[model samples]
Target chain A: MIELEGLTKHFGAKVAVDHLSFTVRPGVVTGFLGPNGAGKSTTMRMMLDLDNPTSGTVRIDGRHYRDLAEPLKYIGALLEASKAMHGGRSAYNNLLCLAQSNRIPASRVREVLDLVGLTAVARKKSKGFSLGMNQRLGIASALLGDPEILMFDEPVNGLDPEGIHWIRNLMKQLAAEGRTIFVSSHLMSEMALTADHLIVIGQGKLLADTSMADFIQENSRSYVRMRSPQRERVLDVLRAEGLAAVEAGSGVLEIDGATAEQIGELAARHQITLHELSAQRASLEEAFMQMTAASVEYHAHAAGEHKVPAKAPPGAPGAPGAPDQPGQPGQPAVQWGRSYEERRRRRSSRKGA
Target chain B: MASVPAVLQSEWTKVRTVSSTVWTLVSALVVTVAMSAGISALMKATFDELSELEQATFDPTFVSFSGMILGQLAMVVFGVLVVGTEYSSGMIRTSLAAVPQRATFLFSKMAVATALALAVGMVTSFLAFFAGQALLGEHRTTLGADNVLRAVIGGGLYMGLIALFSMGVATMLRSSILSLGILVPFFFLVSQILISVPKAKTVAQYFPDQAGSKIMQVVPDALGSDVAPYGPWGGLGIMCAWVAAALLGGYLVLKKRDA
Candidate 1:
């Protein structure tokens, strides 16, 4: 188990990591999510005691990293950069040196090389290896001691499709063995597929810590979208039923509080011809964007609509009362917890009408 | 805490696994021996053309070690590479992760490389002495003579110290290119050139190479060289002081800085 208590780091007046506290429990892969320039790398470095923490402490198996008899046997880390191996040395020898340092058996070197599928290139220097090969060699090194806690920072940056698939399964297999696996990535789609739990941060602050299913359910908007040929009649019926229905675009109406079954029965009772009635849940990417909209540091101005106005509170995930139109100044903050299917249903109902 | 012996073994593996270590050490030996023999032969051929003072104070013991002027550069390369490659290749982070105790890692690596350098330096010194003496013919000084054995053994220690000093500076600078950019010129050009300049000679004599080379001279101020204030042992002591200061600086840098 790795526990960080109020861990914080500052690089000369710029707060890189601010009081991040969390635990990575065993038997699950925890995906560490953040935007670019977030303090994921800094937090990992502090866990290994490579960078001294300014204010807090990191305990690995209840002991400080430096206090452990042999750190590699307790926690293994693969940093974002594939920089842990000597290019002048062969793949086999690079791991051999690490094994010897930790008093791990020399035989384990060959085992890990085979595990990473680098047995054929064991004698070749790493300088001649491609980025994928280098990443595999780094994984081989990380597994040299068979530590219980494993951390990887952007392990799939330059990997091919097959390599990506291999690593995803490898992480799952490792976590299944009751090892604590913590992996960080900026790609929400990748995290959604692999991670069972998520620990999210934005601008070096902990934003969310929850299970994957719960995080999506709470942060994302899911609602029923309905379309009818007689858009005016449907709107009148919805109003008479005391349901607040907003016209999306054309003849469709977006209702947030009612379920598809309730809306379907209501339209049938009123003799309205219903074209489509389905529920839509926002994608994980959209939920992540909404959550970190204010914390993104490097903003590309090309898409002006994506910009979250500077006045929005950084801690507020989604603030209401923001105008939804583009080209409008002082637009009230975006309303979270509302599904986008309403807008699409309005457009479809207009086409039908 | 990390096991010292384990780390030492690991450092040994790191050094021997690379081809550069073997090539650099072999070149240091071959170049020193071959070049000293060549210079010795040339001196013997021109023995009749020498001036009276030059001929009288020739110092045959020092002549056998003349190749060191060029050869020590190879030693410098070997030392810088042993420490610098860790940073250049980005292996230091991994190595430190295995052994988080900074002192254990740095000192163990230095111990292994320094021992190898000392062994190679001894072998190279003996070979250069024998070959250069054979070429010198009648001008050669026997090991049995006074101060000759000290000069011979001191030659080996000088080479090893040069390499160790380079390792310290490399650790402090943390880059092979940056360390070499400074050390190569300081040893090959700056130190040598300053020794001959009218006003610079006084301080230049106390430089690491100039002071250390005193151990190889059987006669004071041999071959019209500048006379130093200290004796042979004192000069070696001065060089050792420089090495100590460098190693201390390197240790502090490694301990204080992030990997």
Candidate 2:
């Protein structure tokens, strides 16, 4: 287990990490999520004692990192891809040096090499290895000590699909063995697939700490999207049934607080011919964007505006800085529902004008 | 805390596994011996044409080690690479994470590399002296002569110390290119040039190389060189002080800076 309390780091005048406190428990893969420059790397470095925190303490297995007798035997980290190996040295020798330092047996180096599937090229200098190969070598080095805690920063950044699948399974297997697996990535989709629990940060502040399922369920909107040839009758039936139905462009009526099954049965009893009926669940990516929109340091304004035309402006009700409770007043999903109605009214008024 | 022996063993592996260590140390030995032999041969042929002061002050012991000027540069390269490549290749983080004790990691690495350098330096000194003496023919001085063995051993010590000083500087600077940029010109050109200038010679004589080279001379003020206030061992002491200060600075930087 790893615990950080009141961790803070300042780089000159810029606050890189601001009082982050979280615990990564064993027996689960905890995903660290943040946008670029959200202090994820800085936090990881401080955990490893590579960067001195301005004011904080990190305890790995209940002891300070520097105080650990053999740190590698307790916690192993892959900070950046291919950066931890000597370019001029062969992969096997590079790991051997680390093993020797920690007094780990030499045989474990080959074991980790085989574990990462790099045994074939173990004799080759790492400088000549491809990015995928380099990442594998890094993972091999991290696994050299067979530590109980493993941390990886963007491990899947430059990997092929096969490599990605292999790492995903590797982490799951490691976690199944009751090791603490803490990983950081900006890819929400990847996190959704790999992370059992999530500790999210935004602008160096703790945004959310919950399980993967709970985080998505709480922070995102999932509603029943229904379309009927007689859209007016469908809307009337939904309203009569006390369902909060809103017109969601293109003759579709979106009803929250009701399942597709409930909505379909209601439409059938009213003799409304439904053209389409499906549940629209928010993806983890959308949930992540809503949570971190205001804290995104490098906001590509043009790209963001072009891609998400109806995205609410910063400081809008339910935007970042609001409470974390979903479906509450001023929550992202509620504000988005209100905005959709506003947009539809404006479009009809413009036509009249 | 990390075990010192383990750290030392790890550092030894790091140095030996790379090709740069082998190439640089070999070049230091080969260049020093070959150049020293060639110069000794040329000096022997022109001995009769030397002036009175030149003849009086011609120390065969010092002459035999003349190739050190070019050769020490290779030692500098060796030293810089030993510490600098850790930064260049981004392996310092991994190394530090494994050991965690900054003092242990830095000192252990320096100790292993310095031991290798001292070994190679002693062999190179002995070979250069024997080869240069062979080329000198009748002008050669035997190792059995008074002060000859001291000078020979001091020559080896000087070469080893040069490499150690370079390692300290490289660790402080943390980049091979930047350390070489400053150290190469300062050692190769600036130190040599300043030692010859009328007024600058006073201060330049105290420079690490100029002071350290005093140990290689069997005769005082050999070849009409400047008269230093300190004796040979005293001069080496001054160089040792420079190396110590550099290492202390390097330690401070490593302890305080973020990896």
Candidate 3:
């Protein structure tokens, strides 16, 4: 178990990590999610005692990292590959030094080499290894000690599809053996598939810490879509029945908190000919975009008509920023949330152009 | 706390595994011995060309070490590469993670590299002395001669000290290129050039190399070089001070800065 209590780090005038506290539990794959420059790398460095925190403490298995007799045997981390090993040394010698430091047996080095499928190139210098091969070497080193807690920072950054599949299974297999697995990534799609729980942060602050299912359900909106040539009649029926429908452009009406069957049945009762009727569930990717956008918006514009209390407070799911927000709804917060999403999309496309 | 022996063993592995360690130290020995032999031969052939004062107080032991001016640069490269490659290749993070105690990590690596350097330095000095004395003919000094053994031992110590000082400077600079860029010239060109520039020679004599080389001189004010304010050992002590300050600064930087 890895516990960070009020962990914080500041680089000069810039706050890299601001009072982060979370426990990574064993027996599950916990995914750490954050946007770019969100202090994920800095937090990992502190966990290894490579960087001294400005304040607070990190305990691995109930003791400080530096106090551990053999730190590699307690917690193994893969921070960066292709740059962490010496180019002049062979892949085998690179892991050899790290293994010898932690008092790990030399035989285990070969075992890990085979585990990562790098047995053939173990004698070759790391400088000649490709990105994929270097990543495998890094993973081999991380697993050399066979520690209980394994942390990988974006382990899938430069892998082929097969390599990606191999790592995904390896992480799940490790978690199945009851080892604590903590991995970080900017891609929510990967997290949605691999992570059992998520701890998300933005702008160096905790945003959400919850189960994967609950995170998507609480932050994302799933609704039904309807398209009818007699859209006016469907709207009239929906309004008469005290149901709200939003025109989602392109002659489609999106209705929240209602099933497609009910909407279809209501249209039939109103004798409306429908062109399309389907239920749309918001993806985890969209939920993440919205949640991260809300955090950025909170940092930029803390006050205005958009009420953070109504939308982000009640089921904030362990967010430290929730209780600090104003505790009343001055206006609907969904309007501004959608607007922020639009702006983010436009800004990204502009950068691409 | 980390196990000191385990860390020491790990550091030894790190030093021996890299090719730069062998290449740099071998060059230091080969270059020093070869250059010393050449200069000793030149001194023997030029006996008649020397002034009356030069021939009267000729220090053959010091002449045998004339090649140190160029050879010490290799020792500097060895020391710099030992510590600087960690920063350049980003291996420091991985190495630190394995052994998080910064002092233990830094000191252990230095201890291993310093031992290797000293061993090679001793061998180089012994070979250079034998080869140089053989080439110098009648002007040669034997190991049994008064103060000759100390001078020969001092030659080895001087080489080892140069490597150690380079290690300290490289630790503070944290880059092989930057450390080599400043150290190669400071030990070779800059200090050598200032030694002939009138008043500049006064201050230049206090430089680490100029002072540390005093230990290898058997004759008083050897080979007509200027008289130093301190004895041979005292000159070496001054160089030791510079090395300590550099290592302290490096440890502080490692402690306070983020990896």
Candidate 4:
């Protein structure tokens, strides 16, 4: 278990991390989510005591990191990739020095190398390894001591799909063994697949700390869209039942805050012939954007300004700020970091206009 | 607190595994021995051209280590790389994490690198002395002579101190390129050139290399150089002060700054 009590760090006058207080409990993988420059790396560094905290303290398994007899055995952290190893030395020898420092057995070096599938290149210089290979080596070094708490910062940055799948499974497997796993990334989609719990930060402030299921249920929106031959009768029935239904185009009535089962049963009682009663649920990606859009630190306003087109429907499917939308001037991912509250105000003004 | 011996063992492994350690230390020995032998042979052949002052205070013991002016640069490289590579390769974070006690990590690394340098420096000093003496022929001074053994041992101490001073500076600067950029030029050009200037010589005499070189001289004002206010051991003591200050500065920076 890692406990951070009011941890804060300041770089010059800028507050990089503001009073971040949370505990990463054992037996589950806790995903740390934030946009770029949101103090994830700084927080991790302080936890390891690599960078002294400007205020507060971090306790690893109820002891300060430095106070632990052998820190590597307690917590193994892979900060940044490739750059941490000695490029001049072979992979095996590079890990050997760290193992020897804490009096770990040399045999464990080979075991970790094999664990990361780098046994064949164990003697090869680390300078020659690819980015994917470098990440694997970093993981191997972190596992060298058989540490109880494992932390990885942006573990899948430059990996292939196969490597990404491998790491996701590895974290799950490690957490299954009752190890505390803390991983950080900007993508919620990745975390959705891997993280059991999430601790989110935005602009150096804690936004939410909750279970994955709760985070999704609270932040994500779901509504039922109904397509009926007699759309007016369906709307009349919904209005009589105190359910507000809007006429979506093409003879469809959309009801907010109602499940498909409830709408279907109501239409059946009303003798309304319904062609479609499908539920539209927001993706975890969209939910994450809504929660964190206001507190994003670095905003990339491509081409001088982002022109939110007037009279356009806001929050529509496939709108800007949606992920996996390629070939934009800048990545639309930045749009996801915009202030959701401010966007709503602009949207209301557009309606007035 | 970490066990000192275990940390020392880890540091020793770090120093020995790199190829730079072998190249730099070997060159410190080979270059000094070869260059000193050549210079001593030339001095012996040109004995007739020497002035009365030059012949009167030849000090073959001092002449034997002449190549140190060039050779100590290799020692500086050795020392700089020992500490500087940790920062350059970004391994300092990993290293400090393993042994979180700042003093233990820094001192253990230095202790390992310094011990290796002292050993190599001793071997280099002995070989340079013997090779230079062999070429000097009749002009050669024996180790049995008064002050000769002290000068030879001091020669070894001088090289080790040079490397130690470089390590301290490197740790303070925190980059191999930056330390080498400032250190190599200062030792190879600035310190050597200032020693030749009449007015600047006064301050140059107090420089680490200029004061430390006094340890290698067996005779007073050897080779017509001006007499220093301090004796040989006192001069070395001045150099030791510089090394100590640099190390203290390094430790403070390492302790206060983020990795």
Candidate 5:
């Protein structure tokens, strides 16, 4: 277990991590979420005693990381990639060096190489390996001592889909084995599937700490998408039926609160032929944006309207749906709790563009 | 203490695993031995022209120390590779992470480097001394007579000390390029150039390389009175002092500074 109490890190006048406190317990993958320059790396560095904390303490397994007899056996960390002295030495030799330091058995080098699927290339110099291959080697080095607490900063930064999937599963499996696996990443959708717990941060401050399921269920809302040959007819029926609905596209009306069953029966009774009907729960990414919209420090032009919806409180998971238009009937005037599904769809569509 | 042994093993791995380490050590041995033998042979062929006193003072031990001038360059390379590589590659964080006992780690590195240098120095010095003497035949100096062994052994000790000295500079500079910039001229060119200046010779002899090189002399030169504060042993002592100061400074920096 890693417990950080009132941890704060200040680089000269700039507070990189500001009075942040949280516990990364064993048996779960706690995703450390933040935007670029959000101090995620700084916090991780402090946790391992790499960077001194200006205020507060981070204890690993009840003792400071530096105070431990053998730190690698207690908490293994991968703060940077391809950091094991380059390709000058073979991959096996690199791990062997670390093994000697941590008093790990020499044979474990081969085990970790095999574990990360680098055994085939273990004899090769790391310099010749691709970025993804290097990342796996870094991971293998981290697992050298089989420590119970593992912290990885942006471990999936340069991985392919297959490698990313491998890491996500590895994290989950490690957590299942009762290791405290904390990983940081910018992609919220990936975090949704990989992280059991989320620690969202923005501008170097902790925004939220909650279970992923609860965060999604409580903070995210569900919405229904609808389309009809007679768009106007569907719009009138939705308004008369007191269903909050808005025109999403030329003939599509996005409906909320009413289920597909109710919408289908109502459209059928009105003799309106429905062309499309789909219900979407808020995605973790939208909930993240909704929670962090205002706190985002750097907004890329590509981030687009995906800015945290105006309604969701900073760190609050659920907010009401953001209006498709400036003013839609179902959409609340207050921009909060945008459904996660709508956020995902918006991001996906944006990407598709 | 066992932990210290483990640390030493780890540091050994660090040095040997890098091809640069192997290349630098090999280069040091090669350049130092080859140059010493070559210089000794050239000087020996002209031995008949030398005064008895000149010949008496010419300890073959001093001859063996020749490679050190060149070998020290390799020593500097080795020292810098061990410490500066971490800074250049940003691997110090990983190193410190694996061994959070910062001072122990540094000490272990120093111990490993010193031991390796001493062992290699002893072999190189003995061979250079023996080979140079063999080549001189009638003029050949033997370890059987005079203070020959002292100079020969001192050559090895001098090499070991200078290697540690380089390690100190590496710690202070923390960058291979900068350390090389500072070490090369001070040990190779600057001290010699400075001492050549009539009045400045007094101060130039106090340089680490000049002081350390005193170990090569069997007789104190007249220059010792005006240039060096002590005899050859004193010069080695001064160099050792510089190393101690550098190592202490490095330890403090490693202890207090963030990786």
Candidate 6:
């Protein structure tokens, strides 16, 4: 189990990680979802005490990483691929060093080598290993201590399809054994398939913390794509009913916050949308984008501009600044950390423009 | 602590497995012995007929210079491999994470470096001593003489100290290239230049390389001159102080740094 309370880290004036708080429980895979530069790596580093947090604390199994008697025995973390082993050393020797430090028997080195399927290359130098092979070596190093808590940052970044499937199953298997597995990734599609729970962050602030099912159910809004001879006419009618719609290019209007039943009823009343009116369920990607679009910090272009678009669609209960319960004081809105365009597209009225 | 032994074994594996480790150690041994032998043989054949006092006062500076120069080169690399290798390869993170007790990791590396350097230094000193003596025939003094034994053995101690001293610099600089860049020239060129400068010459005599070189001196210089603060042990002590200071600085930075 891992718990973080008010975890914050500031790199000079820019806040790399805001006052973020979340718990990772055992028996499940908690996917840490965030766009690039969303403080995922910084949070993980602070969690492992690799980087000092400016104003918060992170506990693993109810104890700080530094206070643990045997740190490796308590938390097995693969921070980066290159942190695994020296390239010139053989795989066995690398594990041997760690095993020696933690007082594990030397035989365990071979066991992990075999477990990672690198036994054939055990004595050979790791300098020539591929990215996938290096990742496996890193996993072997992490599993060497057999700690109940595991943390990996972007484990499947450069993996092949087969390697991806193998790791996905491995994470689930590790979780099934009641180990707390916290993995970070930028891809919502991968998390949808792998995560039992999701903690979404954008621009260094918590955007959503919920189970996968709840996240998908609560934030999943339906959209309708309309193609008709009179596109602007249908858009104007939908707009009059206060429905949100945007032209998705190629004369297709994507209407949001309205289902097919209401759309068909309105279309029948207006004598329109006879050509096409297809309903589109919001994907995890869209829900993720909607939840975090306002809080993203670093954009590809901007350096220090922290601007959250004001017109982000009303999201589920945990949308920025929303309180946890009715009539309760809501948390202050997170300080925006990115440029205006990267945060939101403002696609509310494309056809008019 | 039993962990100390484990750490040593682990570090030994780290030092031996890498090609740099083998090359550096080999360079130290080969350069020291081969250079000493070649220089001694050339000096003996060339300067065969000198006065007894001239021969007696003759510092093995020429023969010792071979191995010292080579040993210094190898020791620089050896010192670098001990600390700088971890930074280059990023193995220090794994090493530190394993042994979270920071001082233990630093001390263990020092122990490994000390033992390996001592063994190599002793062998190279013995070979250089015997080879130089053999090449000089009647002109060369035997190890059985009073100061001869101390000088011969002192050669070994000097090499080891130089190795440790280099390792200390490596820790401070934190890069093999930077450590070597600063260390090699300082030992070979800068110290010489500093010693030749009339104003700085007195202080330069106490600098690490020059002061440490006193250990290999069998006889005092004929000119009545003020001597360095300490003789053989004092020179080695100066170098030792440097090693301790470097290691301490490195340990403190490493303990506090983000790595």
CA-lDDT, candidates in order = 0.84, 0.86, 0.84, 0.86, 0.77, 0.75
Candidate numbers sorted by DockQ from highest down: 3, 4, 2, 1, 6, 5
* Residue ranges of candidate 6 with Cα displaced over 4 Å: A239-242, A268-270, A300-353, B48-56, B60-62, B221-226
Total clashing residue pairs per candidate? 4, 0, 0, 0, 17, 2
Q: Which stretches of candidate 1 lie over 4 Å from their true place?
A: A224-255, A258-278, A303-353
| Residue A313 alpha-carbon offset, candidate 2, angstroms | 26
lDDT of 2 by residue, A30-112 (tens): 99999989999999998988888999889998898888767889998897867878999999999999999999999999999
Q: How close is candidate 5 to the true structure, as a TM-score?
A: 0.84
lDDT (tens digit, per residue) of candidate 1 on A208-261: 889988986686555566788888888788777767665644354667678889
Better of 5 and 6 by DockQ: 6
Candidate 4 DockQ, CA atoms: 0.76
- Could you tell me how far off, in angstroms, the CA of residue A120 lies in candidate 5 after the best superposition? 2.4
Tens-digit lDDT track of model 3 for B1-259 = 8888999999999999999988888999999999999999999999889987788779999899888898899999999999999999999999999998889999898888888888898888888999999999999989999988888888888888888888888888889999999999899899999987889999998888988888888887787777789988988888888778888988888888888
Candidate 1 versus the native: TM-score?
0.87
Clashing pairs in 3: none
| Candidate 3 chain A weakest lDDT stretch, 10 residues | A306-315
Candidate 4 per-residue lDDT, tens place, A128-209, comes to 9999999999999899889999999999898999999999999999999999999999988788888999999987889889
RMSD of 2: 6.3
Q: Considering TM-score, which of the candidate structures 1 and 4 is the better prediction for this target? A: 4
Best by DockQ: 3
Docking quality level of the chain pair in candidate 4:
medium
Question: What TM-score, over all chains together, does every model reach?
Answer: 0.87, 0.89, 0.89, 0.89, 0.84, 0.87
For lDDT, candidate 3 versus 6, the one ahead is 3
Query: Where is model 3 more than 4 Å wrong at Cα?
Result: A227-253, A267-275, A295-353
TM-score of chain A of each: 0.78, 0.80, 0.81, 0.80, 0.80, 0.81
In model 2, the clashing pairs are: none
Cα deviation in Å at residue B233, candidate 1? Answer: 1.6
